[model samples]
Target: MLKEVYGNECSSRTQVYKWFKLFKEERETTEEDPHPGPPSTSKKEENIEEISKLIREDRRLSIRGLAEKTGIDKECVRQILHESFNMRKVCAEMMPKLLTPEQKESRMKICVDIPNNIDIS
Candidate 1:
């Protein structure tokens, strides 16, 4: 309507008023997207549950086995065990059985059996 009013005179009041109005309208019309922010900071729960399931199903599984099962790297599995689950390797007890009195004496005689012929006596 303002362009229709301005007939190439270059002094039209309507053109100045409409330009300012359009500029203000454009400023109000444009808006930044509301969803802008950092990416997700949490891991998927499914991955955590899968890791837990794999560990529970085989407590003694090697890191490679766990990695195969969970689709993660072997190093990653070890990290999850150490950091997330607080797991450690359990050592087997290897102490010998209690010795009988006769067995003890026999062992002691064996220790003295060395070099009886070379004794000072």
Candidate 2:
């Protein structure tokens, strides 16, 4: 039996029958025929731009919030944030993976200020 021999690698019995029928009909190849469908529209340039605008407006917005606001899927939103914008979440806010010079300087100032401002108990 295919179940015993092939385990999960084999197709369903119905699909095997369908393929057999196709082969009997003189189908040249075992590969599937092309079936046209509507184009994918979710991850377009427009969507990328919209996401960029939303992030600039509020860096603290989560992927779920972005998806709801843009009517995009959560995974797609996260992909856009990571791949398109090169961003990641830090302290519940989206930030670039690489810091800008100004941002580095600002962080340095904050780090220096923190130790100076702390008082011994």
lDDT of each: 0.57, 0.82
Q: lDDT score, residue 31, model 2? A: 37
Off by over 4 Å in 1: 1-44, 91-121
lDDT of 1 at 62: 70
The top-ranked prediction according to lDDT is 2
| TM-scores of the models, in the order given | 0.37, 0.60
What is the clash count for each candidate, in the order shown? 0, 0
Once superposed on the true structure, which residue ranges of model 2 sit more than 4 Å away at CA? Answer: 1-39, 114-121
What TM-score would you give candidate 1 relative to the actual structure? 0.37
- Give lDDT tens digits, candidate 2, residues 11-80: 6677666657766786654337431222345678999999999999999999999999998879989998
Cα lDDT of candidate 2 equals 0.82
The best candidate by TM-score is 2
List the pairs of residues colliding in candidate 1: none
Model 1 residue 76 distance off true place after TM-score fit, in angstroms: 1.1
